[model samples]
Target chain A: MNRFASAITAFALAILAMGAAPVAAQQATPAVTLEGLVKLEKTIEENGKQKVVLEEPKVVVPGDKLLFTTRYRNAGTQPVDNFVVTNPVPDAVRVADESALREQVSVDGGKSWGRLADLTVKGEDGNPRPATATDITHIRWTVPVIAPGASGMVEYHAIVR
Target chain B: MKNARTPLVLGALAATAIGSTQASAAGVTAGTLIQNTASASYGSGSATTTVSSNTVTIRVDELLDVAVSALDAGSVTLADTAVLSYRVTNSGNGNEAFAINVSPTVSGNGFDAAVQTIAIDTNDNGIYEPGIDTVITNGGSTAELAPDAAARIFVIVALPGGTADASASQVRVTAQALTGSGTPGTSFAGQGQGGGDAVVGATTANANALGALLASSASVTLTKSFAILDPFGGAKPVPGATVTFTIQAAASGSGTVSDLRVTDVIPAGTTYVANSLTLEGAALSDAADSDAGTASASGIDVAIGALPGGNSRTVTFKTTIN
Candidate 1:
């Protein structure tokens, strides 16, 4: 190919990498994706220190807390800055305050977020029990930047109602 | 003209290079996707990536809570059938079957009746309709009760015809949560309805840990005595003597006797005083409605209210010797 044509082609490819085909940018140049999983929490004493870890849950019952993880990966060819990821807590479950990742909870669907301790839920008597796992509707994590081929995960524990 | 032409030409011919300064643009963008997705913008437009994750949905575990309630208490005659009914409730999160056991033997708790038979109210109507109800045998079972539901059970205890007066009996009924089997405090996985999940509740048949009470018939006895007042002043027994007849009735044993009537005939030598009836040191009219007694021509008839075991009543009247 001629040098001038090669330069024009490189320019066009750069513009394409910018995700400029109207609505085609979202599907361009590899994509950052997310995966979720649910696991059970187990604690063991290691060297006189309690080490908490998540294990696969075979079956869970009432009073048992479960951990949910959402892993995000930047598989795109180009570096992407400022990414937002959200995960919803299913109905009939409450948040378990022990979380591996810093997160915010949304009691009103996914519209807003706050600390779990500050949130409140109406109890059987109509009074408020400080919102725990049971009051969380959604969980969120903010990633300042997700470089190409980078991956990260967020996790929080919850108990079934 | 030459100078004016030269200045116009210089102004028209001037070719000076110009420099320009730039700044930045202001705006924001948003995006979302099904299941899970990520959106990032590096200096410009960004694409969102989405991936689906299977939802690990499992039904909530069922909690098994059992409770028992006894029927109201009433009087029971010897050799009679006293229906001791108990309602077992499932105050849990899931449906559960219960086992009912009634023990005639009374040990630590309290007195008890001889349990002849234990029966389950199949229809849950609480009445002991023979055919409708089935006897709960050695290993009897009750139908499943949903959360907050109950089953009524009846125990028929034949009062020993020899059951002595004042002696009491107790009938205790116990119900256990039969759904998930294990010692209390032990939990199992997927050992519940629909094979979902469960936690064993009360294992003892007596979930309520209470006993119903039944007491035998009470015995009451009557005693009569007399004290005399002198015709003028002091205590004396002679012609024209004013005699006060005291009748005492008391129940000796543990139960209660209803509709107690005490009748005394006027002594042959004494003329009955009109309106001279007093019960327990209180003035009583000569009528049935007054003070549970009455005084008529034949004699004094006193109708005491129910005489409970270990209780007594005193009736007094004055008669003058003619």
Candidate 2:
């Protein structure tokens, strides 16, 4: 083939590669991004008053209180509706709070959701027993919509088991 | 952040604060990796998309704690070798060795005991064996113990001679984690099982127990007397007179004297009296039998087996002068 035809073919291949890169980037980027963070809850005396604060969990042991926060932001140009966030309690931890607002818990591995008092688990004696905070397996929060460039966060407290 | 919160949260914190005062001995193993992730699903129109957040990872560290308990009874005999037993437990979340320390002398003790030897129950038996039990010196460390495991230890102490009965001595035995010990939360990097950080527990990784020893001494005292009565019914020593011998045996101290017996040899000038032996006003046969007392030409004998302290017995017999 002539040098002019070969040059045109190389240019065509370069344009195709440039077009594929943007499309791949668009597919890889999600319309909404989520971030999960864990922090140690500490009660310190400040000005002779007990104050609660969150710090990096450098050291954690059993019975230590911890806060898990999940932040979601709409990164797309259009608004998204029916937004929901769900998190599973780690095996080594137990939910420390059962009455936190804007949230529900599932003791049956996301099969059903309700208040802790409304849930029951089969006990060792094969009888239905009221579920406790330790029986919580999943936590969930729902928002009707997240407009473009809007962000929101949900959080819960848990203790190492 | 708002200070307004649920009462359960406050209650939990308060309870946990109180719980932290005590040493926590059980929990997840050290160096356990825990990870968590959250998922979010949304719909912009007809299409639904789901995304996951970055995972959060945490590694559980080690907690160091130790406890010691005394297994010895409350009392021991004076001038005797007293073996004080103790159990040392590893109350931590990892395998740890402990250094044993015994203080043979404690404040407020009536007498100080001389520590002879410290030994471990190498075979896991509760009793101490001379050749089998492994003897350890003061401040010596024990073998590595797994979490919640225990080791029996025996501290041999000698009570001082002439120690007053009822005198008490206290010995303190302490077990300290060999990995490290200090204020709670003191951490040693890369020193725990699986190379995780080792942190001191609420017990400061050490615990001690006090063993009490009360001195007991047993003894028996005897007293004898004789009354003479002539044929005219007068108390006098003369020929053809009847001599009544009374013997009393008393037991004292805080222990028992086993197989206690009293025997009196007949006087050279006294003649034999048959069927005259009596114990505590009870008549005894002349021949040696199952009865407590016996009368023979040679002597008068009485067997009082196992005389406990604070008790006494009396024996009496009559003999005619030759």
Output the number of the DockQ-best candidate: 2
Q: Which stretches of candidate 2 lie over 4 Å from their true place?
A: A1-27, A98-102, B1-25, B72-79, B218-252, B255-322
Per-candidate Cα RMSD to the true structure, in Å, reads 21.1, 13.1
Tell me the tens digit of each residue's lDDT in model 1 across A1-161.
12443354356335534643544544544366667777767777999999987776654544556777777777766766656555565433455766512467666555667777667666657687675554455677677777778898867676644
Candidate 1, B-chain TM? 0.49
Give the 10-residue window scoring lowest on summed lDDT in candidate 2 chain B.
B13-22
- Scored on chain A only, each candidate's TM-score is 0.66, 0.79
Tens digit of per-residue lDDT, candidate 1, span B115-228: 777777877776888777887684587887766667888877765543566455555677777755556445556665545556654433237544445456677778989998
* Residue A49 CA displacement from its true place in model 1, Å: 8.9
DockQ of each: 0.13, 0.21
